[model samples]
Target: MIINCGPLTGFTQARYVIHMSTGKRLVLFRLPSIDPTSSKPNEKEGWSYYAMEAECPHAGGPMADSLIDIEDSAYVASCPWHAYDFNVETGESSVGIKACTYPIDVRGDNVMLEFPAEDGLNVALSKIEPVSEKVKLKNARPSETPTAKQEDSGMARYLDDDATLCDWAVHILNTAHPEHKIELTTHLFAIFTEREASSSPMEIGRGTVTAPDQPPREKMLTVNPGAMPRTGRGGTLKSRIAMLHALANIELWAIDLAIDICVRFATFQTEKSSEQLPRAYFHDWLKVASDEAKHFSLLRTRLEEMGSHFGALPVHHSLWLSAQETAYDLRARISIIALVHEARGLDVNPMTIQKFRLSGDAESVEALEVIHHDEITHVTTGHRWLTWICNQEGTDPVQVFRSNVQKHFRGPLRGPFNEEARLEAGMDKRYYEEMPNVVAAS
Candidate 1:
């Protein structure tokens, strides 16, 4: 609970300011009430300090300048911007939502706040975009003439029209730059927050949208499955990072595949409309897409921590090939992509977790564990939707899935299969049990 913020600065000497490990700024106001048992450096036995989020929630107004001492009252820090007030103890905002507050403590003469033992989320920059320093240096270059300086134009919205919301998601898919991650995250956030990217249907242009190339440096050095260099694992750090990058690459493509499915199949006929299947269908893909984004970011961060990056090594384009094969059909897409391919991911993740554990890379292990559980849920969504489609068409779900696999998926279905995870994900045994026999009989 209480983490050492290191000897409460600005106390007993200057105006108090403190920064949390999570990059949140806080200011210490009133001192703590007396605690007789406390033996801290500047032992003000019963003293504690009140701290509030450094900036006002309303408009980034300064909370320090407008500080209010309530004389042992509930409400502590007050913001002058909109006259908002908050309780330093609880972070409760007088207007509506709670303010950000921290529990302050002094130990061994060191000031500490209630922070966790583990490092918080890797809010560390992933470097998908250039650093601001580079931009500043470029702007500082000397100009030959004192002509009117041209300011950079503002970015244009991808789809421009809210009605063609699906088209905007497709635009994100087609963006091949590394910065696409930023745009994709922003777009997904907007959708969940009900700002832009609506589920409303609009008649798209005649041609179908093709999936974009993976971000540029990432699209580098592609190799066939057999050509993939054996990634080192076990005790060596290099191999561990290399292996994590390979997995991250798969997740990156999975994001694209999920996006492709949503845009590609938005036109499937249903009882609802001709423009696309109901929002339910696309929403399912969006959920998968969202998880894939998180998985990729987690794995990518882990990779960077180990001194390698996602595109620093070669990757097989194997996942996208399945996308191309199923580009035209919803049945084949879910059957082959989610059930067959991703289910294999489920089967192997436990062993992968063990590999990272053996290497003593707990961070990588944790990321893989998250992706592993999510894959089970992702496959469950695919199976549910696949079943829904089968019912809509009045066909047997298992048989149709089998037929689609045979027609679309190449070669033998390989697996020591993660039967438990498959079952957990709602995949029936009869489906896989009959699949090999059905394929063999065919």
Candidate 2:
């Protein structure tokens, strides 16, 4: 592969081929790479210069800098800013919530990159030399599918014990860390090709709660069916608390994916057009991740006091479903996960807190309060990123959001929205203002 590196102040229009370890081949520019600051002018393709896959559109994190393409839809890229997992083909961002599919051209065994001329320097079209293919064509496999077995196995491990060790293993299974960066793509694919049965609801230990004749309010203080463990309330209070803690932990997994996507854009390492965002754009994502981490810890501690722990209850896979459906699109992912889910959190968390409060459970309410405060910021981050993207793309945020949501989700949205929280999150008044009419009509 060859790349015609446009003439820059320091580099020539040199072409270079990159033989990726995954057996895929591509071209790299030999001329001075992009400075990631200069604004791009409308130029012809041959005169256009661009950064390789090192930059993410969501968080601006360095992608190509430390990444390995594991398969077609899956690749392990280390976020230079924060360690995260990124799905290359599907753009399924994990950890920091950011990544984008870049444009490239392939011509037989040769690939080419047309870069823009820098400093207003005009140069003739440069012919790039193609490198010879040493290996037989029949032996090379094009990335076509994701490794299902590896994913399932990793998920199984996570389900079984989700301990700190499991966390590190998951990180390795999902990334190209120093020792685990092995190209097990084919192996993983082979193992997970067939669909595996979904997990069954867990059977938690139950204990009779003998309380003095309870008051009328205590009747309403019963556990929420929606949030309760698969095991009935006959379970010890400690066991029930463990179930809530596990629910919180499950929420963290989803947050991790969202966070990586956001970080990818903030630390993006490419030439920024006048319209493109900067590194500062991603600071809010870090704050969101921190909040999620805190929420997880608080819930865990509360569960411990109840004499149980996270992973003691069965959890749903709906969050992972959203992540998978929007894997190829960042706009959809952010809107659904952050705007839809986290925004709803502002309402849901408070309601849950109220439930605990009425039940005289101070510990749960305290944890919910922390979540509520931080969640305000998280929703705001979504609004900021979503609104900015709308401006950049010259689209209506509300319309785009509605269309994407309809395409991706099937559940009904419970509202009587937390208007105050939405306001803090940077949601435009027009959206919330008109929401009632839209919902009523629907």
Candidate 3:
């Protein structure tokens, strides 16, 4: 049961605390202190509302009484009971106890929270503006550069492949307007071809630019995995719109995720003979980002033809969850996202295409066909890189692949896979032949 607390009071006020109580549960304590750096581009200070459990795990002490580290950039909190420190931004406790942070979001001025619906836990907030209207992208491109203080307006900053692409991705993800993302992404890809992939020593300095990985969306509608609505092949028009929207969102996330692989990992490559990664790594992912942008465009166009817009329904950030989960190891990312997630797409696309075909939605079928074709490349790119990374570590590719599946991939690998497509994508049977107890591709 998610609950709305109220409008955050301290935007200009500097600091304010929101204590939500329903008799001893005293469950929520949200304090928003202005982050002075919020004015910087892509930095959304208010959105970083990190709220942890009310009581400290160490001694059941109320966390509301925790000390704030104003001097420190991470803005951590220290429990006074035993001096256990925690990064409030991440809820990471130095003492190793789960902080049990509740998920919350600030949309417009309204602050919302989600917790167990039990014990009559509910609070409403000030009125939220209706979700923003969609704006179509104008295809006109200026023939000459604008020297009027804006030559590099976001997408035009094609300075370096890794850095520019990363900047564009972050900008797209951070744009608060909730505009036509697919169209914006298509325009961004032109910038990719405009620049060369940088081999400038895996720039630890972002090659030139960088931005936080927060993906774009209106105030998020996040919920537990169990909370997602039950969706299937045959459903109402609303359900079909939802299903298509979910797919479109995955492609949207893939755009950032591919760029993330580029800018985040390229720094590891140096002149040292030990660095196994090469320029081709960035190239492969850039291509992946391009393909993803196309996939998004197709799906979004189809959605409009269906009389639905991109943000007409809710979407979860689960695909990006794979990205966040694998932020530490490139191998884990490939194993889970490509081998497990994209591979599942091979299994599911044909059935989806068949569904659209049955409904006489030729437009959807054609768009999905393009997606199906490109996903082969997407999966292949993941396979190629994971295998290379394995070889660099001097670990057996097959064995390491299995290890990653067990370690990072959450569920059993479902199949009835497109065996032909998987093979074309360079995913050999050994990676999934008997691993994780997958069912055979039907």
TM-scores across all candidates?
A: 0.60, 0.45, 0.59
- Please give the CA lDDT of all the candidate structures: 0.62, 0.46, 0.61
For candidate 1, give the lDDT of residue 54.
Answer: 72
Model 3 Cα lDDT, one tens digit per residue, 129-173 = 221112234332342541222353442322333445556655655
Task: Please tell me which predicted candidate would have the highest TM-score against the true structure.
Answer: 1
Task: Give the per-residue lDDT digits (tens) of candidate 2, residues 1-442.
Answer: 2243333332233323333333323333332212324433312223332234444454444343332323332234444333355654334565546554334443332233443334655544333322221111122223353323445423211122222222222332354221121222122222221111113221211111111111111111234347655542313465346447555645455445444454333322222333544323433443354445456656766766777655555455456656667665667877888888787777667666665676677777766776676666566667766767777777787887776766776655557788766765656455534332232112
Tell me, by lDDT, which candidate is best: 1
Better of 2 and 3 by lDDT: 3
Candidate 2 residue 317 Cα shift, in angstroms, is 2.3
- Candidate 3, pairs of clashing residues: 416-441, 416-442
Candidates, ranked, TM-score: 1, 3, 2
Q: What residue runs in model 2 are displaced by over 4 Å at the alpha carbon?
A: 1-243, 263-277, 428-442
Q: Which stretches of candidate 3 lie over 4 Å from their true place?
A: 1-173, 176-189, 197-213, 269-273, 437-442
Candidate 1 per-residue C-alpha lDDT over 1-442 given as tens digits, one digit per residue, 9 for 90 to 100? 5555444443552124555545766666644443447664433545656566778777665565333434243435655334467776777775787777766665656665664435654322111111010011112213332122324222223444333435655676765543344345345533542321223534443235544544233356787989888876556887787788788778877877887776677667633323346555655566677667777777767766777776788888788878877777888889999888888898889988999898788887877877886777678778877877776777787887788877877666666788878876667676676455334222
List pairs with backbone clashes in candidate 1: 5-112, 7-111, 31-48, 32-47, 32-48, 32-49, 33-46, 34-46, 35-46, 41-109
